[model samples]
Target: MKYKVTQETELLNFLLEATSKKRNDLKKALKFNQVLVNGKSESYHAFLLHAGDEVELGKKSRQDLPFPILYEDKEIIVINKPSGLVSEQTMHNKSETAFMIVNGYLKKKKEKAYLVHRLDQDTSGVMMFVKNKKLYEELTHNWNDYVLERSYQAIVEGTIKKDGRIENYLSENKMQKVYVSNKKGKKAITNYHVLKNVKGYTLLDVFIETGRKNQIRVHMSSLGHPIAGDRKYGAQTNPIRRLALHANIFAFEHPFTHKTMTFKTEMPETFYKVTGKIKK
Candidate 1:
């Protein structure tokens, strides 16, 4: 269901007057992130609503998803992808994937989804897909030009005393593992700053200049501080029982509209649990 706001009011009050559902039900919807304003999820009931705003009560999709939809429109859809799911199906692996889940949801609406980019199977956070072929081609052809920022949050196994940069060439073996190689390999660069150090863990804010496969994982491992639980890169501990890396921020310009778009998700609670810091 959708509503066009005619007057300024608090979101909860506006919903109360606009919908036939009880207050408790509306509150529950807000809590579960079933409400969206102008295509973005708004969980705060006290958020101010103004005239000319588009309010949507998102009904549950037929397909069950482990992740949450952050934003969607006729042109594109963004999701906060959870860990342990492949971004898309592979030649050998035809099992469930993020693409399959989003495609299923769109199929229910008589729409189609196109792959834009990918995240590592163990990496969690913002991912996007285009709804049409034109947009897909535009983005995939000029990805670096349209993408303004890509950042991540990670909990590495050791303490990093200062901000640093890592630059090296990376190559992948037949086994699908990526390693640093200077012999005809792709150059990758990553910059990181220490966010906090708790116990034996170090939380880092990471940015990448070139999106090579496994760039961050290889770079951090070179510094002797592999991401927690990333055994593939020499991590000694599994404090979180999952890769402690997350792609938390993605900012880009819409290929068709040229409008700035940004999506972000909070670091998983398990990250804070291992770091002994509370998320605020």
Candidate 2:
């Protein structure tokens, strides 16, 4: 929706009054970089809108991009982020994050994207982001309802005898290292099914019910099968020379449209090379 201002007003106030949306919703729209002024992406809610200025709401047009666009619509965008890229910048990592890359691509088109979830820096996988605040609020507030299934593919050390599920309480210490705790913590659950045993390593299809920090890494390590190359979780092997974790599948319904959407990615080639042979 586009609005041409006939009188001077602040961007946010004008949006709230014009659209009849709650203040909080309008704030989220602005914070997520959804608002546009005069064909440029604007973040400041307090941005002054002069007479005759143009304002746009809802989905913005996306231009050609340098990176692969796995899927994109007016409501959401899914990107296949490469390994070694942080999902978002942190105090330790200030540059070259996937969020920046996506937003940068959109910025050229005077649009913006906002992340709904994250992937570890060393994990390559499909990631999702929302384009507008209403969708963002609906998805974030009722996350589990929208996300029907999420699965990961990983190469873990040692051979597993059979499929299993790991259920335990996980908590992080002051150093941010996640560990299984009996006395206290949030419940973490991981279900794993062995896909193939190559050489001494096993390829497993992993699924987690809860999105805890390092849930997969910690659960696998507790079973004496830490993902290869995850030094933080006590793996001695670096078979793939990177964390052998990849988010390979997501099945969900659109929050607003309620349309079923499923996405999947093949395991990284490195996961196959170190295992001696790739499974057909």
Candidate 3:
């Protein structure tokens, strides 16, 4: 089966509709890189349709959302992304990432969705996507003025004394991947609470007033409380397969109606365990 394009429906919609009708494997189309548009394979999920676009399901697109949707509204959707998924993909300097998953899902539903903020590849928990371009512009442009707070939960390798504050300069590493900083870098500050201490590790509830690239990772590493399971930092041992970090909540202003919006996500059971207590 096939579909004809329309202004209301996107290319992704046509494929989803067609695939839903058949027992044929949609996952196979996406995984084997079998899907194509206008006689070309397109892995990127946000490929906008301008009408008259042809699609073939080679392998079905993987429905791995990475995380669960904690909250949603007309203006925004808050998702708790699992560890090990990119926020968006890189195509023409763009990325096929988690952001596109939400966008594609809404597109299939005939609604709009756009990226407003992101979490790291290994970082789990709360993230937001805005819909309308106008609303997106407002939130992004006025992010400093709009959002009230953002909080993260992390299990670090060692106990943090004082359950307190840290301030430092941060900058991205150009030669090496993953953002890092030393001195003479942008100012980065993180406030943390040592909620739980066990064995040789500590669980921290972190808050970052400013959104910087890998701010939490770098800052915590510098403070000598590197997040548990972070391979990039001081946690040399593979205690866990993925980093034990998560964004539990993100608060911001509703771009459309000027209302204060707060989104919270629950921690996965693994979040509570460090080295030995992997069982739920």
| Tens-digit lDDT string for candidate 2 (134-195) | 88888888888889888999999999979999898999998889999985899988999988
TM-score winner among the candidates? 1
Enumerate residue pairs that collide in model 1.
Answer: none
Q: How accurate is candidate 1 locally (lDDT)?
A: 0.86
lDDT measured at residue 29 in model 2 versus the true structure, 0 to 100: 61
List candidate 2 segments past 4 Å from native: 1-67, 276-280
Show where candidate 3 strays beyond 4 Å: 1-66, 91-96, 176-184, 275-280
Structure candidate 2, residue pairs in collision:
none
Candidate 3's error at 187, in angstroms? 1.8
- For candidate 3, the lDDT comes to 0.69
Q: Which of the predicted structures, 1 or 2, would earn the higher lDDT when compared with the native? A: 1
User: Candidate 3, after superposition: displacement of residue 162 in Å?
Assistant: 1.2
Using lDDT as the yardstick, the better of models 1 and 3 is 1
What does candidate 3's lDDT look like per residue over 1-280, in tens digits? 3444555454445567656634234533432345666665443333455577667654333443424566777767777676666887654236457777788888887888878887887787788887788988888888888988899988888777667777777676654444444676777778998777778888778999788888888888877878877878777644555688888888876655777888887665555446334423
Q: At residue 249, give the lDDT of candidate 3.
A: 81
Ranking by TM-score: 1, 2, 3
